[model samples]
Target: MRRKSLSTGDLARYCQVTPATIVNWIRAGKLDVYTTPGGQYRMELPKFIAFLEDNEFPIPEELQADRTRKILIVDDEEEILDLLVEVVEGSDANYIVRSEKNGYDALIAIGDFKPDIVSIDLNMPKMDGAELVRRLRSNPETKNAKILIVTGMIPTSDLVRKVKRIGVDSFMQKPIDIDEYAKALDKLATFKV
Candidate 1:
């Protein structure tokens, strides 16, 4: 059956939850939704069905035991991107890390690479991290994709709150710690949804 876009009320009824709970899910990034030009939300039917079947949200799986997983790293700084590439290249964990200078290019790479995880920098030209997160969350294809915010900007508290609010799966601070980065990827690799 083809499913049309649903409103919050429709979602609440189908999910057997209160409207407030649905709103919380949206805020928590547990739900995938997009706002119209008039500011109304449209929910994807297939993902919603998957949520019902699994009783949990879906997220990308890890790279195979034998093959490297594809990862997209978005940042404007050449030096930082280069450093990240170097670190990933040195890791025991197999990963195909692709770097993009800005969010615009990152969006394009997202479609082309179909990465298992995305590490995004908060500050960038064209589109900032917040907007990029919003865009990723809005699109059904990328909505459940694992996202990690790696940024040097923003205070710690603010950064934590913002990332949580947007439903980012994980986060890391700049001056990239190789161990921590590895840990984050490890966690994402194992994450079921």
Candidate 2:
């Protein structure tokens, strides 16, 4: 499927320019963008690709949409979701990372995302992580998915044991340690959807 959009930084990286340059382009009416309520800018993926082609700019190999893996991030905290998205998407893995703030949305997204890896929090609303994990394991489509638990909910020994019993592939605490996060993702990178 065609990726829907690109953040200013994503476009800037592909075009070999600073994100500020992309912002300037938008301000000068050189490039069109949609601004989120949070004031972040996003450009339609197809349109940006066309613009690059028209301008004779060489598109980065990764930007050509040769994504190898899809990652779904589930967390109830909006800030955590944003942070995780930024870290994972900003990496050079060329993985598609999508985030949902609730398990219900995450469940719906999982079908569409068909993710190779799912990094989730334990204490989510609508559906808790344990229930989500059970559902994923029970569903043939997602049973083989690599599940990583990332949460700040103060895990007790029981919680750890329970998650392991549910077949989580890995676990990390928040605020996430970047090295550990990268390591976990790297470990899961061998799996394909």
The top-ranked prediction according to TM-score is 1
Compared with the true structure, what per-residue lDDT tens digits does model 2 show for residues 1-193? 6568989988888888999999899999878789889999989876785577456676565555454677999998888788888889888887888999888999999987888789989888898888888899898778878999997767776656677798988889888987779779977765432
Candidate no. 2 TM-score: 0.62
Clashing pairs in 1: none
Q: What C-alpha lDDT values do all the predictions have?
A: 0.77, 0.81
Query: Which residue pairs in candidate 2 collide?
Result: none
Worst 10-residue lDDT window, candidate 2: 59-68
- Those runs of model 1 whose alpha carbons end farther than 4 Å from true positions after fitting are 1-64, 156-160
Clashes of each: 0, 0
Per-residue lDDT value at 31 in model 1: 76
lDDT score, residue 23, model 2? 89
Residue-by-residue lDDT tens digits, candidate 1, 1-193: 3445678897887666799999898899887899889987778764565555356433322212333467888889999888877777787787788999999999988987877788899889998887888889888778867898998865566655676698899878777887888789877866665
TM-score of each: 0.63, 0.62
Candidate 2 yields a Cα-based lDDT of: 0.81
